[model samples]
Target: MVARRRRGAADADQYKPEAHSSDGAVVYVRVQEDGEFVITDDDGQPYDETELRVLRKYAGEGMRDMLQQACDRLNADLSALATVHCDTLSPRDKPAFQSRAFPEPEPQRNPLLQPTLWSRIWPPARRRLEEQNERRAEQYTRAFSEWEEAARAFNEQERQRREQETELVLTNLDAMANILEEHLGEIPWPRETSVSFDLGDDASTIAIDIELPEEDAFPDVEYTLAAKQPKVSVKKIAATRRRMLYRDYAHGVAMRVLGEIYHRLPTVQVALISAYVPTLDTGTGQPTENYLYSVLVTKSQWREINFKALANIEPPATLERFELRRKMTKTGVFKAIEPFDVEALANEVGI
Candidate 1:
């Protein structure tokens, strides 16, 4: 699958002079250097001049639709952070051996029971039949032996696979980490998000560090159709609103990581998640990461949440139920805070 774009650049690039039919039919179109619309058919031939006006009328409407779509995409991206879900991993059934049935033996005839003189004279026919039956028995025995060997090798491979699945289901630290890494990569986040995991002493606890998007990463502009032409009018998002969005985005990410770990690894009782963004240190002038929020989520407390109604749950409000550490103003302006020390906190909590 193609990765989703995190910025508004893709939308901006699509705001060109393109048109479609009023019935919502797709049209191949491009604007020439001379500022003329060139509408083409599936074969790339230009449409007749008589059909140009009808197609051209919907140009403004199409561009307006594109702008509205871009706005909708931005909203959906924000909502996705808090609505992340994972399917539980279960152990596979044990492998069963499939036995190959042996072939039936051919019937034999006796030369002495023959009533015809020709049959009595051709006694070699009975000998040939006996020899053929012997060869058939030998071939069946050899084939069955080969089949048994192949079945043994196949059963061994399946046994190993079943053992690995069982270990993962039981939440072995290494097995959980390996499978979790694979599952995390398959999530379709709007941004290119990356997370690292570590086992906390045992399988009961896991620590996660998530790379948060920058403050300006959230969409800061509202797009609309202009009054005059097939163009979009831009309105800047208020400073306070943008700040709130960034805060929710960070908190949502923290909750998402916690939820994923608890859901995928049922034996994991606790999770330590920290959300951070890349920044330059003011004093040292070196690149560094500034943590926005750290949270310690327990399975018991997490179960109280109505997972079925995640769409209505506000990430910031939901996080209040957990052990969270953050420095933010009432207006949602976040300040850099030190991430929680997972090992020390786990020891203190006696987990």
Candidate 2:
């Protein structure tokens, strides 16, 4: 076996990129412009990184080929070592290692002395051997643990890099799609250019249609920005996430002021949703019995809509008592909602 390995080493020293892991595993990767080879040694050990010096006087092969050769040589070396050490080892007089599992030692012992002598020494010998073996095993275990942790961290870094790449690709795709849509709009649809929008209830689609009078209008129309601007983002995740641990959605605080009113408001559609309610979902646990409502609207654009004369939008579902505040005063208050809010009120009134 040793002779065979010697031949293998002679054959391997011919190649370039060569490195070995701590466990003696050889590694071969593409050779960089520099003689250094980049590799991972079992875990995150940077021993295999680029710019590593090659001690051997390599000759007669390309960098890649040489590195591969080195790996083969390393593996061969390790195999030889493994063979000589604790494995199906070569003949050695391991006096302390006398065991039925292994062949008899070279210097034969007296069969009678083996019994009495073994009986006397075996107990202490066995204890010492066991302790040594356990320590060795522990050392081996720690080595593997360190290797595993390093490898896991390395793999995670690679994963994050991949995700970033994927995100970049997706963003580029969206940009390209927008460009294409704008170009397509210039082709002129069979129908005239037109536009319509409607917001409806749950399970309802917001229908939007744009009409073009002629193909020429398509070139004049800036559709790309308009198309991309309408995107709605939705996020779905596990409800049991850490941040949601203390969450509680208030189910009932029934109340409704059918005709709440803010007189001559700036045409900005506003709803006075006053209620004595349980605290906000998470940590804030105050009851609404003592909170004021009338907050300004944000996150949406609406024309100057006076709450006065704006029709009260009764929820399609039942309202809890806490949400029900003083009834909106002024019967005229039922007519001042913004166009969109009016549309909503129309639906509510119809319901």
User: Please, what are the lDDT tens digits per residue for candidate 1 over residues 55-143?
Assistant: 65655466455444544443554445334432222222232222333333333332333235554567787666557667777776777
* TM-score list, all predictions: 0.62, 0.17
Give per-residue lDDT, candidate 1, residue 315.
81
Instruction: List, residue by residue over 1-351, the lDDT tens digit for candidate 2.
Output: 000000011122333354554444554443232223444333435432132343122321333454545434433422322121111111111111111221222232222212245545779766666666677667666766766676666667556444433332233333222222332233322223222222223111121212212112111111111122211222232323211211110101111111101111111132323222223334566432222121222112112222232223222112222222232222211111211322432343211
Clashing pairs in 1: none
Error of 1 at 186 (Å): 1.1
lDDT of each: 0.61, 0.27
* Model 1 residue-pair collision total: 0
Summed over model 2, clashes come to 41
Candidate number with greatest lDDT: 1
Poorest stretch of ten by lDDT in candidate 1 = 1-10
Q: Model 2 Cα displacement at 254 (Å)?
A: 71
